[model samples]
Target chain A: MITSIIINGILIGLIYALLAIGLTVIFGVMRIINMFHGEAVMLGMYAAFVLFDKFGISPYISVFLTAPIFFVLGSIIYKFLIDPIPAREREITSLIITLGISFIFATSAMYIWSADYRTVTLPFSQDVMVFIKTRIGYPALISSCMSAVMIVGFYLFMSKTYMGRAIRATELDKDTASVMGVNVKWISIATFGIGVVLAAMAGGILSPIFYIYPFVGSNFVIKAFTIVVLGGMGSVTGALVGGIILGVAEALASTFLEYSMKDIMAFILFLGILLFKPSGILGGRTRL
Target chain B: MFFKILSSVLFLLLLFSQVSYGAGTFKIGCPAPMTGPGANFGEKFKKAYTMAADEINAKGGVNGTKLELVFEDTQAKPALAVSSAKKLISSDNVIALLGGWSSGVAFAVAPVALDNKTPYLLEHPALDDITRKNNDYVFRLQPTTGMYSAALEDFILKVVYPKEKKKQLTVAYIYVDNAFGQGVAKYGIIPFFKKNKDKFNLVVSESYNENAMDYKPLLLKVKNAAPDIVVLTSYLTDGILLAKQIKEVGLQAKMFTGTGAGHSMQDIYEKSGKATEKYFSSGPWHGEIKDANWKKWRSAWEKKYKYVPGEHEVEGYVAIQVLAEALKGVKSSDVVKQREELKASLKALNMKTIFGTVKFDNFDGYTNQNKAYKMTAVAQWINGKLLQVWPKEAAEREPAY
Candidate 1:
């Protein structure tokens, strides 16, 4: 039981963190809510499906290609739809814009894919390894490893690059960062792009684990949003930690309680954390 | 100007000719999930139902009266299905009803058929409650989740599970959290497993959201448990998704099974590739059999639709055959008489179908008649082909998986 709980908790938490990372990054810099964040994930799955079905490209390799493409598409969307709104009025406008984008992407996904669930299967797809008393799946291990690498790469990119610092500054205070010549608007757009890239990467890695459909992210997005908020919006590390914690909690609850109570546990944890530490565990105190 | 006048006269004559066609015409209402999440199945159902109706009409119109197929898309929602059923009854004044690929929609609209006193022929929805209740009008071709599961238990115990069954084969059962899934798990798998507890171990039984994308943890838990067999019952996407993940994670068992005929679809193998090659599943619908009636239906279906029928299509087609048989036996377009005749005929009638004999017992809603399924078949995806692996009398090929 202990082995099962630990193994289940870690693997589930890793994937959860991978999915929520994008939402956190976008929330960090954009200030405007990207309601279509889940659509990005869904689109990424579609992209992976197309690449595999049409070009015979493995999802593992397609992530690198799809990520940049989705990132650019995200940037273009931000430019045309999200950027024009005034900073003071950006939140509401962007909400409507992203929601509209989400619907369009979902509908477009249906048109292209036809709502059939697809998967990318390869050799060694059913390989399992045993260590100690706990058994682990090879594909799950690989996805967690990939997710960890990408999360670290995102951390370094944010901490070690000039554009990264500008993005961070904008996230801190767009008006102040603009006064300091940080190009806050461009940084916001680029940040949105980066967020999409993360989502695409996660999608590519996780597609084999989940079915590819137009509304694939419909259920996960709400949880992603909840995780992002629980992580204290705008905190990358917070998102990662929050997602993992949520996943672990849900897994444990499912093991102990009825499976119906799993989602309820996640919300209860959120409310509990909010009561104890309103700003979140890693969400630094700030004036919103 | 003369040609135009003649064409107008011809068109008016055609319209006038059909105006008197309703005197002996029978109205059959179709409630399907045409435009929503389950649209593909619904569309297939519509095609099959229409094709069946055309065949019946071509055969002198069921006692010299034409059969009119009235269709309404339920959008796979309960509220929409209820309203659609109402519309079909009130507006179309349909003598009888057909089509319901979704269980929730069927359950929601079942009352409408009762209220309107129209015999509702349920095609594909497998919820146990549809026939379990005391209803004279509702008739279903496909058995409930319980029937499928019961047949599966018999198949596994008798055929799949070896004579010297291991006493400690840990089993993890995961299913979608819905009426179909709940019904299958609660009434089918659990009871059978409980009776055979000494033969195998029941490790864990869990339910997951149908729309969940990340199932790594669930897979991980199953992995750690080292279950010998994993029984899964989910919709198309999640079913395939679970199979793919199970393969990628290298989870292996003596057998992996599904409750219904969902795994028999081309998409399951097409999407998951060799991952599901060796899996054995039981479904009430399979085409690779040698029943004369099935052969006729197959030839006609191929010639008409140009694609081989899936399980859903077969069930849909058989449902039409049932409705046609009932309507033909009744010889009346009156809704009340049609309902009575359809119900009586369904109970007493027998269909030699692709899945062999389909006969209903009494109207017990929990299961189909007293004996739930008309027929159950065990099939396997061996070498990229769905082969009938059980009921040796109908067995076309040996199980390769």
Candidate 2:
């Protein structure tokens, strides 16, 4: 029973990490806290649902298509919505702007999709593979593995590539990076696009496990924010670790204690981590 | 010149009388969540109201005075429902109010309807307190949550879970924390747990917010508890989400019953895919009602909507049809006069509804009428089709899974 909980916790944690990575990147590089991050995820799910419903595209393939489309969408949002705010007032102004964007996106989504719950069914939707008397969902395996790959790919992209170095430099010191001929505008757009792409990728994978509704983003935003805080704000690795911690805590709480206690567990972990580590498990002094 | 003056005066008097009599248009206001999380129920109410009003109009307009329906979109918010009710009464000049889906929205509009001295013919709001404490102005067409819970409990006890072999009786309850969920918990689930304490063990009980997307934690907890039955008292979106998760987790529960008749929708089956076939729920109305009148109504409604009348649509239609019968029986268009006559007629009514006979007992133009609230045939998804499963007399097919 304990082994199963741990495995389930790890799987759920990995998925949360994947979901939170894009939000963290957007915050770290662009310094814009996107309130619409979850909406981007929901939109990706809807994209997959439309594909499956209309053309019978496999969810796995839909993920690849959705990610790039959402990347461009994120770039467009950054250009139009976030670019207008002055740099000095970007902190407060960006919140309202992104909030406005979130509401607009959510409303437009409702108008287009009609707020109905949609889902994609894969061959493994209900298939359970038992390993040594422990049962795991087949799609859950796909979600976790995909999340891990994305996290690693994200780290490598940030560390090795030229654009990646620019993003990291900007995260470290925006003024310095801009002075070093970084074309900070493009970097911001690229970072925002990557963040949105990650969100979309998570959505595509997670939608099969969770139902798709226009308002689904509302719940995710809360968890994603909690995860960001728990992981240490502005830290990519922190967000990933925070995601896993929260997921595992939730699984454990629901397993031993009451399921209702999971929310309380999240808050407690957030506070405990803040008070004790001050920086998250993998988080450094730099803002995530 | 004197003859001309007399003719002019007579014409003027006739015009004045016509204008005053024309004021008896009798507007019934429909305020529902036409756009929001709870919009499906609202849409059903809207369709049913339109069908009723159109039919009434064709039959010479509700006792010679037209039934003017003014629909206000409240978006399922309490503040909006209140504001919409005020506008409908004060600005739109509606004589009475009719439709609402959520109990919170209904409660918000109820006081407004009362303060304005207008009768509110509540179509589908099912909070117990709405009917229990009693105001004379609020008239609910559907049964309250308490009534539904009680009837459902009785049905389950007498029909589903017989006492002779009461083994494997454990329940896990998950619901949204709003009025709809609370009412089901307070009236339906809590009582069942209380009475059948020896027979049933409640392993898990949790409440989630309305727009909940991730139910994995909840599903995991329920599965760990090892329940033979899972009772979910949630509406549309969450209903499908939770069911999907349950299938994903592979909990081999004998019965998964939802409080509302949500599984009947094509959207649910379409989204849930094969997952829906294992789901069972109770709705107020079933298309396969064996009665001849019900069959006729079902055929016509199916042809028109491309879908059979669900519980909400059927109840909404029945509410209007009963109102029509009452108006016809009383032969009055006066708003105040019709209110009284309709109340009395509804209380004493045993009219055949589209689903079955609607007979209200102690139905005091107020609360807990019809003690005769039907069990509402149990329907299950069979090969993605929602088929009737209970009361073998009416059932078209055997219960699958």
Candidate 3:
């Protein structure tokens, strides 16, 4: 029982890692918290639903559709909403603006889709593997694998590409990067877009397994933020660690205590980390 | 510009209300969650009752005066429900009202209707608290949390207990920690077993935040108790997620039971497929019933909706049917006279509906509460379809555990 719980915890941890990574990536480069990231994920879930409901497209196929559209949408959001505010007011402005965007996203989804819970039940939803008498669900396995691929792919993108180095430079110091001839504005916008793509991908991967609705994103956003903070600001690896820790903690807590009490434990752990290790697990590194 | 459009809409509503009040129409002020979180539910409610009312209107109006349903958007919020109730009472001058989806909204709006002595029949909101307050003017046609639990108990005694080959009658509750869920715990399943201590043993009781993503740990706790039955109380998404997780964790008890409403959704069988096989649940309405009227309505509804009407939406249709039957009995359009006549009609109402028979019993101080011989439809998921399997007379097939 404990082993299965641990495995389930780690599996969910990987998905949380993916979402936290997206939030961290945006914060890594732009230093502006994309409060609408959850909304972006919510859109991804709905996108999958529409494709599945109307066009008979699977979420696996819908991810391809969601990615490019979300990329363009994210870019537009950054260009118009995030960039227009002066840098001096950028942080607060973007926060409030993204909150509005989030509200619009949720309310619009509520209006258009209605508040009915939707799920894309695939063939592999219940197909499972047993190891040491522990059940491993296919949905969780496939989603965890997708998260891994995306994380590794992101790492490769950051280390190898010229544009990636420019983004890294902006992360290190924006003004200094501007002095070094890097287009910091373009880097921020691109990072925001990429961040949304990551969140959307997470949404697509989980759409088959998790229940989808208008307020679905709100469920993950707080946890995503908690993971980002637990991992430390701008620490890519921190997201992975923070997410795993949080997931495992929730799993063990729920096993021992009530399910609601598990949240209390997670929040307590969050507070403990903040009180003692404010720098985070791998904070101040500023690495992608 | 927004205000102009808003006011224009308001003006139209006001003008319509004023024009309808001119002798030839009977205004009914109702609250629906047409524009908020409860919009889908509200939409379903509006459709069901409107279909019932429209059918009556098409047949040449209810006693010469056309029934003008003035539906105000409550959005299932308590404040909105109260305001809308007030607006419907004062501005619309509706003698009777309906709608108020959530239990809290129903409870909140009930007092406003009671204060004005308007007949406010709650369509589906069911909390023990709503009826326990003893408001004579406020009436409920929906199943209470306790009733749902009792219905589950009925299934256990009728189906599981009779069929069990071994000595295993252990039960557990893995429900959401909300008013509806807790009410089910407090006034619902717990009380029945408390009386039937020899019949069943309550092994585990677990609660969680409704939106909590992880249900595995909770399932593990339920598994530890080694319960024969696991009862869940949750909303649609939570119900679906928990049921999925229950299967994913591979916890197989003798039977998995759902308290009601949230568990009775068609999407559960649709989404989970074979996972929900043999899952027992109780609902306010099941498409399969032993009545010609219900059968006709079901066929008509399915012909139009492309699916069977769920229990959640059917309550609205039933409430209105009872209300309509009561109004039709009264023969008066005058507010004071209609109100008096409506009360007498409702008090003596013995009409049949697509949902069930309508007869409010004020037994045990539950003033004007809808009563029935078999208020619950105990159903089991069989091959992705809910088959009514209890109340032997209503049973399509024997309940299989």
Candidate 4:
């Protein structure tokens, strides 16, 4: 039972890491919280749902389509909404602007979808694979693997690719990167685009496992934010580790204690980490 | 001077028009969660209310006055409900109120209704205290949380245990942590189990916050407990998640049932796919009532809404019909006297509607609650359809289990 719980926790944690990685990356590069991150995830879910419903495309396959489409959408948002604010006021202004965007997106989705709960029920969605008394749904297993691949791919992109290095340099010091002829504006756009793509991809993969609704984004946004804070604000690896810790802690708490104490346990761990290791497990030093 | 005179004439005309419009219609304020977790209930309520009002108006309305519904979005929050109630009573000047989708919201709105002396007909919230508070102004159509599981309890005691030939069975409960959930467990399940302690053993009783994305850990705990029957209380989103996760975790129980709410919703079956097959839910409406009006209403509702009406829609539609019936007896000239008369009329109401005979009687420490009507009807998901399976008279199909 404990083994299954831990394994389930890690599987879910990987997805959580994928969800938060976008927020952390955006914050790392632009020094602004993308309040619309969750809504982007919701939109991705809807996009996947539509493709599944209309075109009979599987959500796992739609992830490939959703990523590129959202990449373009993210670049457009960065160009119009995030680019106008001056650097000095960008952080606070971008937060408010993104929040407004979040509301608009949510309201629009509700108007379009009529607040109904939608799910992409694939043939294997309910198929359970049991190994050593541990039951894992095909959707959960597949989505977790997708999340793991994306997280690893993101890490590789950050460390190995020149564009990723440019984004990292911009995160460290935009002025220095600009002086070094990195084109900080382009890096910021690419980083924002990547962040949006990651969030959308998470939503696409999660569509089968989670209900798709306009307000569903709110359910995951808080957790994503918590993961971002718990994982040293900008560190991709921190997000990964923090998500696992929180997930495992939650699983343990809910299993041992009452189920209602799961969130309380998560927040307690969050507060403890804040109090003791304010920089988080991998907080400040690892920017990427 | 000429332009000023024309403006004065237009202003006076507008004022008189507003007054005449008010005189020709009776506005009922509806406070519902139009945009939150409970938004689906609100949407159904809106549809039911609109349908009832349209039908009523088409037949020349109550006392030759058209029924006007003033909707206020409460978001299912207590603070928001209170404000909506106050706004409805004060600014909207709605003669009566309808629709409270959550217990907390109903509790908050009940006080405002009492304070303002407005007759509030609550369609959905099932907390027992809403009526037990001795507030005459607030009347509830739905059964209290405790009564929700009555039919399910009967099915378990009579059909399930006896048919399975089990002398004793272990039960586990997973409910949303709220007034409704707690009330069901405290006032309903606990007492029933205690009454039949020799036949039942409660192994696990757990509560989780609403709108939670995951229930794997909770289900794992339940799995460890290994109860024979698992009872749940949840709204739509969490209900669907619980069903799916219960299947994913491979938690095997002889019977899985829900005390209404999301478990009774069609969305759960559709969204959860085969996970909810054979699952039972106990609620007020099962769409299989043996009555012509019920058949007519159900057909019309499904035809218009493109989905079958559930307990929420039934309660919403009936609340309107009940209020309209009460309003028919209100012949007082004064506004205050009219409200008082409406309350009296509601207390005196003993009508046979499509749902059942709705009589707001005082019993079991409850005031102005429709205790005359049978509240619980058990429905099960059989072959992708929710079919009434309990209460032999109302049963559309036999219990699969």
Best by lDDT: 4
Worst 10 residues of 3 chain B by lDDT: B282-291
Q: DockQ for model 2?
A: 0.34
Ranking by TM-score: 4, 3, 2, 1
For model 4, residues B1-401, the per-residue Cα lDDT tens digits are 99999999999999898777766788899998888677888899899999999999999999988899999998788998999889988877788988778998888889888999999888788889989999989887778897888888888988988876778899998888988898888888878887998999889888898867678999988988889999998888889888999989989999999888998888999998868999999877654388888999999999998898888888888889999999998886665677889999999988888777788888989998987336678999997888888889889899898
Off by over 4 Å in 4: B1-14
Better of 1 and 2 by DockQ: 2
Writing each residue's lDDT as its tens digit, candidate 2 over B1-401 gives 99999999999999888657547665667888776666667778887878877878887886686676788988789999899998887776666677678888887887886677676766578776776646656666566665555434654666656743666478888877788778878876777777787767887888875554456666766777888778887777777777766776676687787776455576776766566665776645453366687677777778878886667877787777766665554546555565565556655667666645556544444453444355356677776677666656656687664
Find the 10 residues in a row with the least total lDDT in model 2 chain B: B363-372
Fraction of true contacts kept, per model? 0.46, 0.47, 0.54, 0.80
Winner by DockQ between candidate 4 and candidate 1: 4
List model 2 lDDT by residue over A12-62, tens digit each.
888888888888788877667888898888888888888987999877788
Q: Which candidate would rank higher by DockQ, 2 or 4?
A: 4
DockQ values, each candidate? 0.33, 0.34, 0.54, 0.78
Q: After superposition, how far is residue B190 of candidate 2 from its true place, in Å?
A: 3.0
Candidate 2: lDDT of B333?
51
Model 2 spans > 4 angstroms off: A271-288, B1-25, B149-168, B201-221, B322-352, B355-372, B392-394, B397-401
Ranking by DockQ: 4, 3, 2, 1
CAPRI classification of candidate 3: medium
- Distance (Å) between predicted and true CA of B242, model 4? 1.2
Q: What does each candidate score in C-alpha RMSD?
A: 5.1, 5.8, 3.9, 1.7
Choose the strongest candidate by TM-score.
Answer: 4
Clashing pairs in 2: A233-A288, A234-A287, A234-A288, A235-A288, B360-B370, B361-B370
Query: Residue B138: error of model 1 in Å?
Result: 2.3
